[model samples]
Target: MDVPIKATPKQFYDVFCNKTHYVSNVCPDKVKSVVLQEGNWGTEGSIISWTYAF
Candidate 1:
């Protein structure tokens, strides 16, 4: 599921590498929070969890 946005690769990569910031900025209404549960972002085996409300 890849969707293209009007951002550079670095910008896009930065957002996904830091999901909390991106999710908060883009989907603050639907997503309450984002947490990194394990491993450093941009590294292997990284895990991220999102708290959201419908």
Candidate 2:
């Protein structure tokens, strides 16, 4: 899913790629946790895991 936002690419990366900024700040009730499984955040081929409730 592609989302168009008001923020620039850097700003988008800075927020969404900062691990739990989206989950913690935006929708904490829906997401439990986010784990960087294999690679680094904001990097290509990075593996991310999400734990959500409801």
Candidate 3:
């Protein structure tokens, strides 16, 4: 599954890694919210919970 985008690799990585909480803003219809349940964002062994509108 290869999707081409204007952003560089670092920018794409930053969105999923550092800006996970903002994902809902990008696609509000599909993603309700993303919460950090344990540890910290972008850290090893960390946990994140995602809520979908469906």
Candidate 4:
């Protein structure tokens, strides 16, 4: 995939680490689906996992 050259790659590269409040609840305090976890900053030997069930 080709990313837009003028896009905010630096900020967009983040996994919502800077802003967490904007994230909504998964199940209103019960069951949840999406998850966000923090690891190391930047893309140096770091990995992010995303999963969903259908």
lDDT agreement with native, every candidate = 0.74, 0.71, 0.86, 0.40
Q: Which stretches of candidate 3 lie over 4 Å from their true place?
A: 1-6
TM-score of each prediction:
0.55, 0.55, 0.72, 0.23
Model 3 score (lDDT)? 0.86
lDDT of 1 at 42: 59
lDDT of 1 by residue, 1-54 (tens): 676678889877777775444766776888888777888765668888888897
TM-score of 2: 0.55
* Cα lDDT tens digits for candidate 2, 1-54: 675677778876677766542655566787777878887776888888888888
Give Cα distance to truth, residue 27, candidate 2, Å.
2.2
Q: In order, what is each prediction's RMSD in angstroms?
A: 3.7, 4.4, 2.5, 8.1
Ranking by lDDT: 3, 1, 2, 4
TM-score of 4: 0.23
Clashing pairs in 4: none
- Which candidate gets the maximum lDDT versus the true structure? 3
Query: Ten consecutive residues with minimal summed lDDT in candidate 1?
Result: 18-27
Each candidate's number of clashing pairs is 0, 0, 0, 0
**Tens digits of per-residue lDDT for model 3, 1-54:** 575677889987897988788788777899999999998888878899999986
